[model samples]
Each structure stands twice: as structure tokens, then as C-alpha cells.
Target: MGPPERTILGSKASVRRPKERLEREERPRRKITVLPTGRQFAVVRMDPLAMVSHLDLDSVAIEEASAIKPKKYLVYLDAPQDLPLPQSQWCRFWVQPVATTLRPAVPEEGITSDMVLPIHPNTQYAKGRRLMNCTPQFPFPHCYLWIRSMMSLRVRTKRGVDVYDNDKAMTVSIDSHVAFMSAWNEDSRRMFALRRAALSSLSGQTPSSEGKLRKSPSPEVVQPNAEHSPSFATLSIPPPLRIYRDGSASSDDEDTSQASDDAESPHAPTLPPIPPLMALAIDTDVFGWAADPKVPFVPLVDLWFELEDHLSPDNIPSPVELWREQETIGA
Candidate 1:
């Protein structure tokens, strides 16, 4: 009862306050070092609902949003398994068709008799043949446009468009006009083919940005002497992955040879004849680290898919396939 029983007002607070408990429990964990070479790996937690908020953070570097473009995808008949097509014939066939017609998206007025394909290429009995080229005579008549038209029709028709697993697919829906445009241009057709081939390969491999551009052999050609030139594809790319199994086989053979030379060898009696060497190779490429810490990079496949969605409709992948193999690749 002495000194008026000291009343401690602030000490009356609860030991475990709700706010303190939440602050302690919900705090984000500190980032940890990653493997191979242990270095701190930064963590970025972005909520879909709060994307803008995260994007606006002072620490984040904002890039100018690129205008989204659609990818171009063109469909043509696949080469028949039995029929081996000569390169020259394939090139020649693209230029002319017996009954193939051309209706330009923007047919120029100066178009004379020389400007039209005259008639569509007669592909009636041509097994495994498809018309993909536009007549050169037509002013600005693009083959891609025609192909896009055809693609659009097919995509909308009863026979649903069925693209192969490795086909080059864009994000945008392949509309009628785009398909027609793609059909009218040889360059576009080649691009489509190259992309398809690369996509097929990349579907099984790890997706990377630089790899995609370098994926297809460069279209560039360089003159050797005065007259002839060679495509970049002909130029040797130092083989990325060494045929290790081949080396192993060679080593085994060398070992066998050495053993034969030595008279004293145990268990040398018919060592299963080396199992008739079946060759295998691990395909690999060297990835260089960036020297500068400031620059950010994006993968080529991602860029390609992004482009496919906006500018060109032909490159977009089919929805069903996109959903199925999305986890497996650049899709």
C-alpha cells in the first residue's frame, strides 16, 4: 500500500500482439545462393494482380514495351515419303502452276496481261505436291498472302487445320488474309520452312534466345572466287557436341588392339565382340556468361513466338497443340 501501488500503464500491453505476430510470420525469406558456383540469386515475387505495382518498383528496370506482332504460319503439302524431289524441281515448281489463280489483297491498277499468274498451277494428280509460290508478274502480288487465305479457309472449314508437332506456330490466329499473303512470297515460305524445322528441333531441347536465331543456317551467301557462292549453311559450324560415344568406341577398339598385342591377358576369350558399336552423341553448345551486369536478355524462341502473335497470323500455333506441349518448349 506504500507509494500508491505503482500503476504501470504501458506494461499492461499483451505479450503477443496480432500485428507483431503477422509481421514476424509473414515476412519474406532472404534470398539464397544458387548451385554449380554458389552466388546470390535474386528473388522476384510478382503477383498477377499486383504486376503493375511490382513493375513500377524503383529497383526494377523498365523496358519499353515492344509492339506485339503475330507470327506467320503457312501450310503446304509435305514431301511424299516415296517421292524424292530434286532441289531444282522443287524451286521450279514454285514459280509456275497450271490452274492456280491470284487475287491480290491490293491489286495495283497498272496490272496488265503480264501481271497475273494467268491460272492456278494444275496440281490435280501431283501426289505430295502443294502450290506455295505466287507468279512474279503480278505487281506486288505476295505468295504468303495467298497461302494465308488458304490457311484461313482451312482453319474455318469442316476439315480443321492439323499442324504437325514440330510446325512453326505463332501466337495470333492465322487469319485468311495473312495466309494468302504468306502463300504469295517465296521468302516467306522459306522462312516458314526454316522456322518449322527449328521448332521441331527445339521442341526436344532447352529453349534459349540466341540459339533460335542461330538455329537455322544463315540465309547469307558469300562468293568464293568470282562466280560461285555458297549459302551460310554450307559453312562449317565447329560441331557443338563431340560424339563421345564414338570416341568411347574408338577407345574400346584401341584397347582391344592393345590386348591382342599382349599375349598375357585374362578373360580375353570372346569379350562379346564389343556389342557391334551402336553410335550415340550428346549434342551440346557452349554458353558464355555476360560480362556486364546491367544488360538483360530474352530468349529467341520467346521473341519469335511473340512476333508470331501480332504481325503475322500464320506462325501462331494451334490452340490444342499449344496447350498440350507448352511445358515442353518455346510454345
Candidate 2:
């Protein structure tokens, strides 16, 4: 048989090329917004008297006495939430009253007192659990509570029980300013009446005593500066509120230019002038660490008496309404 003709091969141009794997289109990663860091249950307010009343004490009379101090101001702290499971297993809570000073205390000098309350691990961070009772009364107007967590070694020794603490704690500052203000406002009328009665009684004292009292130092009077005296017109007239879009005061030139523009466009709608911004004052010193440097103190909680209506939404004025009120007052 004749040799089979060799099969003819197609030209390379006509031959199909192997398909390359399709490149995957990479998806754009989602942008994550980080939230501000805060504690789960750092500080919350509770009725100090009610907390003391509920304590299981051996003597009911002692509990009653503690709960019913006439002149004493009490602050009670309770665990608002549970601690992490790991921490709850081994951590024990403790609180100590530390002295507060105008200047930070030197750790080497020692500021913590001997009055430390050790709390059980099971109820250390339990929700609604009473932790400590704090009294703002001290030599200083303000004081700090040193709250710490210590790990129990679970070992008992004859000499003493050994405990491990990383020296980490949170310090909460308690001040009598708010309490004083509230008391003062409540008794102001009675205080004035008592002062008047005392002044009348002072006339009955002996002449020798009166002489000594008269010789005591009198406060220096402050006289107003005559050179920088404000005139009646200046006192009666309020400054014009010329706020710009960027919260800056408009310059005289800018005001004049705006007036001219307004005059040129006689039918232009008039926009109300912006009022001065109201500033909200917040006291930040309510949270601070003790002067001791040995412990790494975190200022995580602030305990203070705040009025219920202090920052209520209903009390806040809308921007437009505020501007209108200012205009009316100025007129």
C-alpha cells in the first residue's frame, strides 16, 4: 500500500491559543469607623442611704446610725455591670480613701490611708452590687477614692495571705462644690435672717468686746477706675452680633460691603443675624489620679452631683430662635 500522505498541519496563525486564567478584580476594602474608647460601667450614681440600709450587718442599730447622719454627705458606689469572665474568676476589688491636695502628692511620701475595704471576687463587678461608701468630708474640699483590683494567690500562710496586684487602679475625685451650692441656695433666706439676728445681738456684748471687734481688720474697698469709665450710652447699648458663616466676627469693611450689596439689590431677602454661640461649661477636675506614682492610676470615672435640668434638650434654644431673641433684645 502506498504510504499515507502525512497529515497537513494548520498554520500557527490559524491555530487557537490556550485561554489565560481571568484576573480577579480585587474588591475595595470597606472603611471602618472607629468608636471613641470608653469604659462599660465606670461610674454611676446611687442613693447612699438606701445602699447602707440594704447591707447585711450584724448590728441593725449600727446600720441605722450609718445611714442616718444629719450633717454628713454620703456617696455610694455600686458595680453597674459584670466584669470580664476571666477577671471575675480571680479579681478582688478594693477601695481606699486617698488625700487630695492642690498639688499632686509624692508617691514616695505615701498618700493612701489605712482604711481599705476589700470586696469579694464574686460580687466585685456584679451589676447593682454595692462596692464602697464615700464621704466627701476631709481636711481638703475634695478627695479621691482609689479603686483597684487584686488577684488572689489562693494561698494561705500563717504570717499573712499573699495577694498579687499589678498596681493598676482608677481614682475618682469627689468634690463638695455642688453639694455646697445646692445647700447654699436652699438656705440663703434663712442664712440672711440669722445674720441679721446675730448683728442685733452683737449690740448686747460688753464695750470691751465691741472695741476688740472694731479693731479687727476691715476688707479693702475696690474703687472703679475713673480713666476707663464706661459712659451711659455704652452701658445701655449692646454690641451688634455680626457673625460670619465660619463663626467669625465680620470686619467693618465686610459689613459695609454687605450693606452696599444689599442696597444695590433692594429686593434681596434679608437673613437674620446669627447670635453669639453659647458655651457649655463642664468640670473636668472631677476625675483625677492620686499623687502616688507607684500605682498606674487611670482617671476613668467622675462622680459628681449634677442637676437633672442642667443640660436638658428642652432647655436648649434652637439656633434660629436664639438669633430672633437676640435681635428682639437688641432692638
Candidate 3:
């Protein structure tokens, strides 16, 4: 159960319900599809900071962009659109969303490429010489769609690893208080997710633990109420995933921490809260080592995503103001 609903993008919950939307046009060879399942969303790739800095939230329709705690969806944008070339030989696209949420699974004790993402034997570099960057371990062709929520178990990378010509939908289900995202192309250390949490408690408090604070594990996860608007929709987090070493994969239900060690997670450094009105800046490593160890890799790929915490004090009324009954009626 949750509190009463609040209007988002200036609209009510009824407006966010799913509708029979028309299928968008697609180009040959390349594809982009938004399932008519959850709330409406706009997916485009650009330096979010460049656009958000000039964005006027007041001018935007107050009728809620999505539900208060919106159901997530896949924002497929793998179109062959022209992207600005990187300064060097390599380029990276670290996918992040301003309005979305996730609960990143922490990297377990022992993790490998096959465990992180599936490795197909037939489609791998051994068989497909034409496939660039294809390694004995890393077989994925390009960055695809993925969604990691507070309750997700494993990734879909392995869903069709064995199926031949398996064009099986590597789709994502955007559940309530969930997140939709692009494939995680970075190493295990850098892998993290967005967290859908109550920002009201975090609004006043600064980070007490090394400029960061995490939610304590609870059996009953708090579900966001569409009726209530939070200061921010979600949080970026270092969550843990199932583990497998010499044995098969299994969940260590006893552990509740995000990542185990510091050195193990250099990519996901301890982050500070983004200042008021500033976008959350994140860098994702998209490096692919070459065959020869002697060859020096000059240009390292990195994708940057600047996230704007749309939920702020200015938009939502303070609790003190909402409950204060006009100058206090003399105690």
C-alpha cells in the first residue's frame, strides 16, 4: 500500500494507462520498437547535459511525464542514426536515463564474461570472422536494451545463446518502479543500476557515509505511489547479483551489500549527490581489448549520461507546508 497519488507532468494516473498505439516506422536492417505496455516515454541519444541546461521545466506541461512511480519500458534506439564521432578511434555510449529508475545487482564474489553476459559458441569470433570485437568470451554484436529493477533475477543475454538464428526477443518487461536501459557494455566493476526510492528522506540529509548513503535491505520493498510525487523518481545504485565460481550460478540470499570490495569496483566509484538542478553525470567504460597483448590500445571508449533529478523541492510542496495549519492554532 502507498500514499495518495500526485499529478506528474501536470496529468493524473488515468492518462498514463496503456493504449493501442500505432507501430512506429523502421528502416531496413536496423530496428526500433516501443511496446505498447507501459507509460509513454521519449528515447533519444544526446549529451543530456547540453539539452537539460537550457531546458525550462516550467514551460513543460505539468500533466505528468509518466506515473508518479512509473512502470518501466524498453526505449529501443539502435537506429543507424549518425552520432558525433569520438575524438579518437574509439567511441562509447554509456546509457543512462533522467526519468527512469533501477536497482543494480551487486557483482558477486566470482564473476566472469559468460556470467556477466552469455557467450554463444557458434556465433562467437571463432566461427564469425567478420564480426568485429568478437572474442571467445564476448560474442554480443552491439549495445542492446536491458532493464534491471529491484527484483530482477538474471539478464536476458543468455536467453537465446544456444538457440540457432534465435531472433528471440531480447525484450524487457517494465514493471512498476522498474527501469529500462541499454546493454551494460562495461566491466563487472562498473556495472550498476538506478534505484527507485523515496527521496523525501534524502532531500534534507547530506551524505554521512563517505558522501554516499544506501538503503537498508528490507523484506517489504516500498512501492512508489502514483498519487504522491517524490523529490526525485529514483537513485543510481551499486547492487549485487547471483554468484558462480567453479560451480553453477546461485543466489547468496544471506548477503545484502551492493558490491563486495572497493578495488573490485573501480568503475563504480562512490558517487556524490548531484547538486540542486544539476544533472547526474556518469561515465561508462566501453573498452574491447585486441587479440595481441603487445598491441597498445590508444583510444578507450567511454559513454557519458547526464541525468537530471526531475523531482525537486520546488515542484513538490514540503511536508512542513502541507501539514502546517496556518501559523499554528496556539498549540
> Which portions of model 2 miss their true places by more than 4 Å?
1-181, 190-250, 253-257, 260-264, 267-331
lDDT for 240 in candidate 2 is 34
Better of 1 and 3 by lDDT: 1
TM-score of 3: 0.18
lDDT of 2 by residue, 1-331 (tens): 5433343367433332222112233544332211101111111121223322333333653454345322111122222221223222211122122212111111111211211221222222222433322222221222322222111111111112322221211212333223322322323344334434443455565433433333222211222123322111111111233221222336856999988898789698877755444211112212222222211111111222231212232232111222222233222
Expressed as tens digits, the lDDT of each residue in 1-331 for candidate 1 is 2332334468683355566677999997532211101110011111112212223223221221221222222222211111112221110001111112222211111111112221123332222333323212121112221222110000100112421222132112234224433433553444455555555565655334425444344322222222211221221111121111212567879999887777466644543433333211112111122121111111111111122234332232221121112111111
Which regions of candidate 1 fall more than 4 Å away from where they truly are? 1-129, 132-267, 271-307, 310-331
Report the number of backbone clashes for model 1: 57
- TM-score of predicted structure 1: 0.18
Each prediction's TM-score versus the true structure? 0.18, 0.17, 0.18
lDDT of each: 0.25, 0.26, 0.24
What does the lDDT come to for candidate 1? 0.25
